[model samples]
Target chain A: MISVAVDAYGGDHAPQEVIKGIEFALRENSDLFVYLVGKEGELKGFIKGFEDSFRKRINIVDAPQVVRMSDKPSQALRLKNSSMAVGINLVKEGKADAFMTAGNSGAAMALAMFTLGRIKGVSRPAIATLLPTLEGQMLMLDVGANVDCKPQHLLEFSIMGYVYAKHVAGIDNPRVAVLSNGSEPGKGNQLTLSSYDLLSKSRLNFIGNIEGDEIYKGRADVVVCDGFVGNVVLKVSESIPDLIIEFLKEEIKRSFWYKIGFLLAKPAFRVLKSKTDYSSFGGAPLLGVRGSCIISHGRSNGVAIKNAILKAVKFSKEKVNDKIESAMEGCFVLKELKGAVRT
Target chain B: MISVAVDAYGGDHAPQEVIKGIEFALRENSDLFVYLVGKEGELKGFIKGFEDSFRKRINIVDAPQVVRMSDKPSQALRLKNSSMAVGINLVKEGKADAFMTAGNSGAAMALAMFTLGRIKGVSRPAIATLLPTLEGQMLMLDVGANVDCKPQHLLEFSIMGYVYAKHVAGIDNPRVAVLSNGSEPGKGNQLTLSSYDLLSKSRLNFIGNIEGDEIYKGRADVVVCDGFVGNVVLKVSESIPDLIIEFLKEEIKRSFWYKIGFLLAKPAFRVLKSKTDYSSFGGAPLLGVRGSCIISHGRSNGVAIKNAILKAVKFSKEKVNDKIESAMEGCFVLKELKGAVRT
Candidate 1:
């Protein structure tokens, strides 16, 4: 049986959407148990429609305080015993196999790090997202996790990303690439150029520098960068569909002819869009931690929150953290990369 | 009469597309004179259909050498006798008001900086491109110029972008924002946070830090960042539309119903697409220089070439160079941000 902990007072929709998504997932999933952490009364109202057996399967952990989306991440732990922090504590104590949250990402990461700690030899943790590409789904790491990072941090991200894609996404011998301005070996500034050198020398299959255009090309299974650049790319990639959909709505509605085409093309558009949809893959899983954890979008709807819960369960089945720790030992990678030249 | 120097041999299609676009523009326009720079012999085939007045209005300045898109930008001055270089020289020497190229961006900026020199107090030059956004048009600066920059460099880019949008796009008191990972007053890496602090103290209508999602919101006229981040955003933005179009093409061709919609809604789609076309804005203009210049895409078709030439003319008329020099007085705004907190 897989046990997953859900932060009830997490996302913007909170207990309402969270409870709905969890109940929806419970229809055919009999082996799964949930520990919903939030105020009992608030969650009780949200879970009103669930059957008694389903409600009984859900173990409630009292957490009255909620983390606001806008709250500073640094302030999370000090407001100790918060819903998000308490939820993460369950994973650390092994009460749950994996913890999932749609709360403030910064606070979630902060509490996860402080509570669960990191996998041995892993200097820092990284959030790895499976980005849909032309060739296949690629792994991009540190999208929002350590915003300001050293070149070494990027090298570590590549290792974690490569391991995730190989173990979780089922790609073997994943090719890792450092995101840079140009494709040339020496084309980037200090952060990228140095990271490129280290990544190239690591045990993983390392491709040279990759431009932003090749991001969707699946040129590499692992594309690593600092949080700032990665976040910008993620936002731009995510928002493009929203922007296109908005433009199409105004265009198709303006005329009868276009409306016919939009209807016919809707299925194909949905398929292509579904490939890029983050919900299909659940949430960005935090790698390099002692325990498994997944961070969902703070504004995730019912469909997305349900997927996040399943992804957390999958993390337990795969034992992703164990594989990452073993891989680090066999690959004394970063030490061997000290002689590498950035340019 | 505005006379624009057109580098006929600059882009991929060369004299054919450049000549056709110019001829097409001339048939609809009467107040413009064009200096077509290339080998006179090469222009014969493409120019055969136009009348004498059209031919005379489009004068050929014979210069044989064409710069390749792959050539090092630093090597631009060594090829001073080439067609691309000579055409731009005409602008600097007062023979033509502005210079435009569809051939190579690096080459164009190198020649523009070499011939025109930097405006006083401008350490590095920048290029500005108008991105289509939901709220309205947003001006992004340093699209290709300085790959590595200081916080003050971004402050200078803000002022230049602010002026360009105000003077050319007709936006008043154009709100400026430094691109960052979060909207918080102090977020992002050291570079963005510092840049934000400097922008906050600037004379331009500086707004606070803006995340990538808000970029398309059209909340700010000038969005400032280093060339590295700007280039990635610009490249990804440019590639997304083509990617979607490719997906649409494959899907529409497979299904009969979707095919009908593709035809009927085709016109509306075309109009909406034309609005997003970067060529309509001409080219990414190299700013902070003493003379006007426009850098076109290397893969530019005939229409893009013509638009680039026309945009150069507009830059000349707007006297963007002189105005940029005036904006430099506010360049020292970063000094006010020197004591900013590291955290």
Candidate 2:
């Protein structure tokens, strides 16, 4: 049985939505167990409606404190008994196989880092997200974990992303590319230019540089970038579908024929929406941390939370951390740097 | 009459579309004169059918050399007699009010900087493009000029963007913003954090940092970013409409109803396409240069080139260069740096 620790007092719709998510997950996986960490009084009232069988799988670990969305990382860390903190501690202490939260992403990342520590040889942890592409989906790392990344950090992200794509996402010999302003080998900022040199020398399937426009074309399975660029790209991509929808809605309201066409084409739009939906993809995993830590969107609903829990379980069962450790062993830059240090 | 030099042997669809664009522009603006720069033999053959009256407005300047899109910036500069070079030289020699090209952007930028020279006190010239927003349009700068930038460069871009928005775009007291990973103060990488500090002290109507997702909301009239980030944002934004259409096309093929719905909604789709069309927006201007220089897309059609020509005329007539010069004179960071140098 895979036990997942979930922060109940997290996300916009806490306790209720998180409780519903736990129930949904429990129903989906009979062998799954949950340690729902939150205020006991609030969580108990919400979960009272669950079936006796579902109740048997759930253990409400009382933690009265709540981490507000606006709380800074330092302030959040001080909230030692908060649901987000307590839940991550559950994973650190080996009480749960993984931890899932739809809380403040920065706070969650900080708590995970402080509690779990970094994996051996990993310079810094990265937030890896699965973005939908024309073919299927691509894994992009350093989404928001490290705002300022050195070339070495990007290499580490590439390594972690390679392992996740190979083991978790099941892509054989995934091609890795550094995100840049241009696709040519020499076309990039100082960061990417230096990164290109390092990535080219690495043993992985490094495919040189890829521009922003070409990222959606599924040219590379894993795209590595600094958190600053990746974060902006992710947010910009997220807003496109909604912006298009808004444009379509306005157009539909302007013409009678368009309204009819939209009504008839609703099914097709539904399919598109589902395909681009972030919830279906589950949560973004904070890679390179010693434990399985998945951070969901702050606006996550029951379905999104449920999917995140499922993803966390799978992430733990797959022993992705172990695979990452082994992959780092073969990293050329890491070894070279270590050798340089020895001299 | 506003005389604009046109590079006939440029872009993907060259002489044919360019000649067509000149014809279109001549038809629209009675006072517009074009100095067509290309091979005399090739261009003369294409324009033989033009009415005698329209022919009076066009002056053919013979230049046998062509700057291919693949040519490097340094190589392009050496092609001194190339169509792009000659066209820009017209503006340099005061033979034309402005220059427009649908050729290589880097080539155009390099030729403009080399011939026309930078505006006094301007460290680097930037390319500013108008992006469609929810309300109207916003000007984003340094789209692909300098891949790497310092904090002061971003400050210069903001100043130039502000001047263009106010003078050419006719935005009243344009709200200038620095694009960053997060919206809050101090929420950015090293570059943005420093830029934020500089922008806050500047005389422009500076809004704080804006996130990528918020750019579409049209909150800021002018958005400033490093060319590397700006170029990626531009390409990514340009690809969205096409990507969405591709997604829709894939979905429509799956069902009979969707196909029929798409056919009925063709008009509305056409409206959306026209609204998002890059051609309608004309071209990006190489701001901070001594003379007006406009760079259109490589795939520019007749309509795009025509619009670009019209835009170049407006940009020159508005005296955007003079306004940018004045704006730079008021720059806080530049003044402080000069003071430091003196000390």
Listed in order, each prediction's TM-score against the native is 0.90, 0.92
Residue-by-residue lDDT tens digits, candidate 2, A206-313: 999998888888999999998888888888777777777887788889888888888888898888887777888888999988999998877788999999999999
Q: Highest lDDT among the candidates is held by which one?
A: 2
lDDT of 2 by residue, B1-343 (tens): 9999999998999989999999999999999999999999988899899999899999999999999876878989999899999999999999999999998777888999999999876887888999877877899988888877878788888878888898888888999999998777857888899989987877779999998988887999999988888888887777777777888999999989888888888888888888778899998999988999888978899999999999999989989999888767665344565432112
Q: How far is candidate 1 from the true structure (C-alpha RMSD, Å)?
A: 3.6
Candidate 1's TM-score: 0.90
> Which candidate comes out best when scored by DockQ?
2
Task: Indicate the worst ten consecutive residues by lDDT in candidate 1 chain A.
Answer: A334-343
lDDT of each: 0.79, 0.87
> For model 2, what is the error of residue A25's alpha carbon versus the real structure, in angstroms, after optimal superposition?
2.5
DockQ of each: 0.51, 0.58
Q: Is the docking of candidate 1 incorrect, acceptable, medium or high quality?
A: medium
